[model samples]
Target: METSIRLEQAIKKLYIAFHNNHLNPECCKQCAVGNILDNKDSWKHLSDHHGSLELNYVGKVHESFGRKFNGYSPLELLKIEAIFLKACGYQLPFHHKNSKPKNPTHKDILFDGLTEVITFLCELDDVTNIMDYTKLFEFKNDKPLHDITEASA
Candidate 1:
């Protein structure tokens, strides 16, 4: 998929994830990029891993490039949020269920943090070892494994 299309889908998922997570819409306003920045410490763990220091630093440094936006627009930042949510298996059309996969769990939050950090690294132009980090962001295909054609009434 094209990067922009993927980004759009990711953004929609993020909005849904945030809502399903019970985050205040007023605080996030359908885009929680500012909320993430406001709670940077919570997200710091995303890059706390030993080898992730470089990747984390690269993101921050790149963030510095755009004085007004921290090197990314609000949409771009939201895209990162979407990437994080997706990494933790946040699919669309959220529904109430009696079993697992109902809402974002604590584990999902931590995984999201890690995903955000890794995605930042992936966006870097200088990074050459993308394969190593790509796996961290992998997600199962959302499309059904089997196709079912519609049946005429």
Candidate 2:
């Protein structure tokens, strides 16, 4: 399926980060949006608090002007980070009192976060979730509803 250049690039970066063990929920420079932005923590300045959906003054101005970092708006970046953090088991607006996974860097934990982020990215691009496998289980008359080749198309 066709995807925006930004989406494709973002996905590629995320995939690499995931496999390279560079993804971390607590680090602004290594989170999902961070990797998409080339591991920069500058996006953190767009919001006053980490994992917050609300935008600050700078973020508002950038959003109003249609500014995009690595092809994502300031708001989109915030949403992506929030999603990642939540999926990784962190409470919103990350803080010392917030509950989080005991092993934040665990592969399974990171994978869960990556799954959600990829789903969101696909939604933004109006494409099917690349990580979805339910179609392979669909059946009609006890036969596979989607052939492997057709599903891959």
Candidate 3:
């Protein structure tokens, strides 16, 4: 329900990118973190390699200074991109020789990537996964779980 401003903004951007055919696993400006950062590829400089968890010198300096782009640390942006790429079926450290989906832009492939990225974002914000619907099917004492809605209200 209650989400950080940055998380909410990031989710909205991702949602728009997904539906608008703007999400791309291979394009730095169209990837998950890029979309979250308003289609900017500057986040790529945070790491020496795409999908790498280690921060480069510039990234380390930003992290040390508490610099946040779009409310996410440089390291967080790298992690988000890594998660998206991995879930989309790409081998880490994205190289032309690395394994990747037959059609990286396919809706199914993008959806899978977005799902994982969203889950990671939720974890970062310490919030329930917005895409998770498992709670709607929950049951207790052989009765449907109806208390969540009531509690939310």
Q: Each prediction's Cα lDDT score?
A: 0.40, 0.94, 0.94
TM-score of each: 0.34, 0.95, 0.93
Pairwise TM-score winner, candidates 2 and 3: 2
152, model 1: CA deviation in Å? 65
Q: What would the per-residue lDDT of candidate 1 be over residues 1-37, giving only the tens digit for each residue? A: 2344333443444445455663321233322343345
lDDT of 1 at 8: 43
Which residue pairs show collisions in model 1?
63-70
Stretches of candidate 2 off by over 4 Å are 149-153
Q: Residue 132: error of model 1 in Å?
A: 3.1
Model 3 clash number: 0
CA shift at 40, candidate 2, in angstroms?
Answer: 0.8
* Candidate 1 residue runs with Cα over 4 Å from true position: 1-36, 40-67, 93-100, 128-153
